[model samples]
Target: SAAKKTRTMTTQSSLKDAFSSYADDLNHLNDKREKVVKASRDITANSKKVIFQVHRISKSNKEEVLEKAHKDLAAVVDQYVARLVKELRGSDFWKLRRAYSPGIQEYVEAATLCRFCKSGTLLNLEEMNASLSSLSDPSHKPLQINILDYILGLADLTGELMRLAIGRISDGELEYAQKICTFVREIHRELTLLVPRMDEPYDMKTKMETMLQSVMKIENACFGVHVRKSEYNPLLGSGDPSYPLMGVAGGIDL
Candidate 1:
């Protein structure tokens, strides 16, 4: 109905439409969030399984286990992102676009397998001590610790321990040994006391397990028994699945 002399169109109705659009957009955003959350949950389960199984094996086989875990994680993460990207092709997802396409590109990019890790550079005890000796001049001031730095400092700590334990010499490194000892003690204490934070979804972790589980499912379907490979594949580089035919851990030519 044309009002008495129509004051130009009020912007109120346009604002309402805009708000409605915003609500729809927010709902769409939530749906994507839920998907990533679920995927992250799956990936976390995989990470835990890998950690547990790898730790059970001989210390000699740590590299193979770690490499396999890395590969499995990379593949699974790629698969997850692929699925999310596929969904964005749907008509319903068309109007609900901002920037992140299903919200996993960053994760996929970061989950790369380190080639340097392929070498038997076992972030062990010797390197740790050497580093500590070099960095130990900070006697005037104690070193700061955080998760990343702590783990990064592992090789040096391990070296200190080796020199103390194996060389039968704990004199020169008494302070460094004490530092390493304190670090390990604190890490273990936290593990024992704190509960696994099941808060944020553990991304890429579940996706890896899902990939492994798919193999088990296939084996169960065909052989009627789970014939999935218990040992991790090591020839992890692109190309054939040939295990990197170079070195072996101990006597096992893995």
Candidate 2:
């Protein structure tokens, strides 16, 4: 047991040494881009914080948290897009642009969960007194999201890894996620650009619907999203219309 303990400690120390060495290099390389990438991964917690903050904000100002996150992620994503575009200087530049497109849709869709929850229309809630409709009482709010949470966890981690891999490119092995970030950022920037124009009528819902429709088609075409309905509705009551999602296990609206 004592020898086992020593071995465990040695392994831990070795891992620490390896991480320390990599971090030092990451901190020093290419204007500390690796550190920035790591920092981005660390900010995943901020998404949860923002989501909860939205719920808190809902109680106070009747403000939509999902909208707030959409605005926030959109703004930061825009800032990063500019930075990312600056990174793509060679033949591979277009790939970076191509990658961010999926991200743009993801963030937009991710915001919807918070939006629907704040609006008391959380459709995935399993124990709601009534179906998704205009509610007269707070008790009607449902919170069934076992499946949704599981899917988002995977996507978020996968995307975070992609971000770090992108950040580390040139300093390390080439990472395709950087290009992915660029593509996503471009889409976010384009979507947000429409906000300030003030000339368009109320088309955001329509636009998002259109975007989701397009996304579904693309995923179906790519074979990235699959359809597998259970015999019974897991969250909502048995319904004619069911939400089809990506991932083999299925995902939330995010």
Q: lDDT tens string, model 2, 103-201?
A: 322432334434433442322323321221222224333212233232333233233323333332322222222333443344334454554442332
Minimum summed lDDT over a 10-residue window in model 1 is located at: 164-173
Q: Which runs in model 1 stand beyond 4 Å of their true positions? A: 1-9, 60-64, 81-254
Number of backbone collisions per candidate: 14, 9
Q: How large an RMSD does model 2 have?
A: 23.9
The reply for model 2, stretches above 4 Å from the true place, is: 1-36, 42-49, 57-60, 64-67, 81-112, 115-254
lDDT of 1 by residue, 27-111 (tens): 8867865664565445445534433433332335547766776666555444543343344333243233223322322232122
User: Relative to the unseen true structure, what is the Cα RMSD of model 1?
Assistant: 18.7
Provide the TM-score for each candidate, comma-separated: 0.34, 0.25
